[model samples]
Target: MQKKQSEWKWQWTKVYDDSKWLFTEWIYPNKLKDFKGKTVLDCGCGCGQHLNFVAPYCKQVTGIDLNTPRIAKKNTRQHKNVKVVEGDIAKIRLKKKFDIVYSIGVLHHTDNPSKSFNNIKKMVKKKGKLIVWVYSYEGNFLNRTAVEFLKKHILLRLNKNFLWVISNITAALMYIPIYTIYLLPLRFLPFYQYFQNWRKLGFKRNNQNVFDKLNAPQTFFIKKSTVKKWFNPKEFAKVHISHYKGVSWRGSGVLK
Candidate 1:
C-alpha cells in the first residue's frame, strides 16, 4: 500500500501540468447543478483537477489524497473556497460530513477499495449525496489479464525512463487505430465508447493516459454486484449504478 502511494505520487509529479477536467463531465454529467451551494468533498483528488470544476459552484470544497496533497493544494490554490488535506480514504475520518462526496478513478487503485468505499461513505451526511467511479470487472477482461500481466511483470519492473519511452510509443501507435478504425460503424469493437472519449483528448493527455495505465502499481476492477452491495438500500434514499462506457462502473446515491 505504501508502494502504491509512492508510485502514484511520482506519477502525478510527472503530469501535473494537465489542466483538463478529464472525467468530471462523464462521471457527473447531470449532477453539476446539485453542487451549487453544496459542501463537497473529493476523495483521492489528484492535483485538484476536479476541484477546479466543482469549486466555482460549490459553497466550499475539501480535497483529500493519500499521496498528492501538496500538489493538489498548489493546483487548487486559486480557489479561495478549496482546502487540500493529506489522508487515505480507507482510514481518514474527518470531523464533518459533506453535502456531496466523490471519488473518481481512484478507489480501484487502492489496496482495499471496498474498505475505502465504506469508509468514505461515512463522510456523507444524511440526506447528502455520494458518487464514485471505478473500473468494472465485468467488461475489463483484457485489463485483468493481458494488461495486468504486462504491468506487473514487465512495465513496472522497467526503469522510469524506459517505461516513459514505451508509453510514448504506445500512445503514438494507438492514435492510428483511434482515428481510423475507431471512427467506423463497428460498435462491436472493444472499449468503443472509451476509445471515442479518448479521441477528444490531445496528444499530451493521451500520452499521460497511457503512462498512467502502464505505471500504476496495482488496479482492482470492481464487480457490478459488489458496487450494488456498497450502497445499502435502507441507508440510501435512492441509488443508481451503471456500467460506464463499457469499461467502468459509475454509481451515486442520496443518503437517507
Candidate 2:
C-alpha cells in the first residue's frame, strides 16, 4: 500500500510544475471571482496548481495533501498568501475554518472518497461554500468501462517509470482521434460534446491530461445522485450539481 501511494505521489510530482489551471472560470465560474478577502482551503491541492491560480484573489489559501513532501511545499513556497501542510483528508484537523473549501479532481482519488468528503466538510465555516469535482460514471459508459478495466487490470500493476512511458504512449495515440476531430467540423457539432474541453486545451495540455488519467493509481467514478447525497440538507443549502460532457461532476453548496 505504501509503495502504491509512493507511485501515485511520484506520478503527480512529475507533472506538478506542468500543471495548469486549464479551466478555473469554466469550473468555478462566479464562485472564484467572489472569493476576495476570503480564506480558501484547497483539499488535496496537487502541486498547488489551483492555489497558484486563486491565491492572488484570496486573503489566505491553505493547501493540504498527503503528497505534500512531493509537491505541496515546493510548489507553494514562493506564494506568500499560500501555506502548504502535509495531512490526510480523512484525518487532518485544524482549528481554523475556511470561507471556501474545495477539492477539484482530488477526493475521488482517495481510498475512501465519502469519508474524505465528510472530513473536508468540517473545515468549511457555516455559510461558507464547499465545491468539488469528480469523475462521473454516467455518459460515455463504454469508454469509461474500458478505462476502468485497464486501470484495475493493467495500469495498477505497472511501476511509476513504466506507467510514465505508457502514459506518454497513450497520449500520443490520443492525438490520432483528437486531430481527426480537429480536421473535421465535429468540434462545431453539438453532438460531439466529449472532446469539447480537450479542444480548448490544444495538444500539450490535453496530453498532460491524458497522462494524469492513465498514470494515477486510484480513480473512482461517482454518479450525480450519489454526489448530491454526500452533502446533507441540514448542513448544506442551495446545492447545485452540474455535469460536464457526461464525464465529470461539479457540485457546490453553501454550508448551513
Candidate 3:
C-alpha cells in the first residue's frame, strides 16, 4: 500500500485537470443542485479539482486524500468554504459526518476497496447520500486481459519518466482512432460511449488521462454484484446502481 501511495503522489504531481463534464457523468441522478447548502466530503479528492466545482454550492466542503494534499490545498485556497486534508479513506474517520459523501474513481485504486467503502460510508450522515464510481468488470474484458497483462508485466516495471513518455505516445496514437473509427455509428463496439466522452477533451487532457491509467500502481475492476453488496438494503435506502457508458458503475444510496 505504501508503494501504491507513492505512485499516486508522483502521478498527481505530474497531471492536473478539472473535467466538469466527466464529473457530471460520474455524479448523475445526484445533480450539482442536490449539493446546494449541504455539507460535502470528497473522500479521495485529487488536486481539489472536483472540490472547486462543489465548493461554491455546498455550505462546507472537505477534500481528503491519502497522498500529500499540497496540490489540493493550493488549488482550493481561493474557496473559503473548502478544506483539504491528508487522510486514508480506508482508515481515517473524522469526528463529523457529511450530508453528501462521494468517492469518484478512487475506491477501485485502493488496496482494500470494500474496507475503504465501509470506512467512507461511516462518514455519511444518516439519510445523507453516498455516491461511488468504479471500473466495471463486465464490459472491460480487453482492459482486464491484454491491458492488465501489459500493466502487470511491463508498464508497472518501467521508470516513471519513461512511462510518461510512453503514455504521451500512446495518447497520440489513440487520437487517430478516437476521432476516426470511434466517430462511426457503432453502438455495439466496446467503449463506444466511453470514447465519445473522451472526444470532447483536448490532446493535453487526453494525454493526462492515459498517463493516469498507466501510472496507477494497482486497480480493481469491480463487478455490479459487488457494488450491490456494498449497499445492503438493511443499511441503505433508495439505492440506485447503474452501468455507466458500459465501462463503469455509478451507485448512490441514502444512508439509513
Listed per model in order, the count of residue pairs whose N, CA or C atoms clash below 3 Å is 0, 0, 0
Weakest lDDT window of 10 consecutive positions for candidate 3: 1-10
Model 2 error, position 40 (Å): 0.9
Clashing pairs in 3: none
Candidate 3: segments with Cα more than 4 A from true spot: 1-4
Q: Give lDDT tens digits, candidate 1, residues 1-256.
A: 4343567777777785343455565465446778899999999998788888889889999998988899898888999999998888888989999999999888998888999999999999999999999899987888899989999989988888888899999999998988999899898888888897788778888898789889888899999999998887988867888887798888888999
Each model's lDDT comes to 0.86, 0.76, 0.89
Q: Superposing every Cα of model 2 onto the true structure, what RMSD results?
A: 2.9
Error of 2 at 204 (Å): 2.9
Q: Pick the candidate with the highest lDDT.
A: 3
lDDT of 2 by residue, 1-256 (tens): 1122665577566765333444463355445577799999988887777888778889999988886544766776778999988788877899899999988888878888888899999999999999888888776475467877887788878877787777777877866776685558765443256675666665566666777776677777788788889766877888878887657788888999
TM-score of each: 0.94, 0.88, 0.95
- Please tell me which model should have the higher TM-score, number 2 or number 3: 3
lDDT of 1 at 127: 93
lDDT of 3 by residue, 1-256 (tens): 3232677778878778778878987988889989999999998998888999989899999999878588899988999999988888998879999999999999998888999999999999999999999999989999889887888899989999999999999999997887888889988888898897788898889899788878777889999999999998999999999999898999999999
Q: Using TM-score as the measure, which candidate wins?
A: 3
Sorted by TM-score (best first), the order is: 3, 1, 2
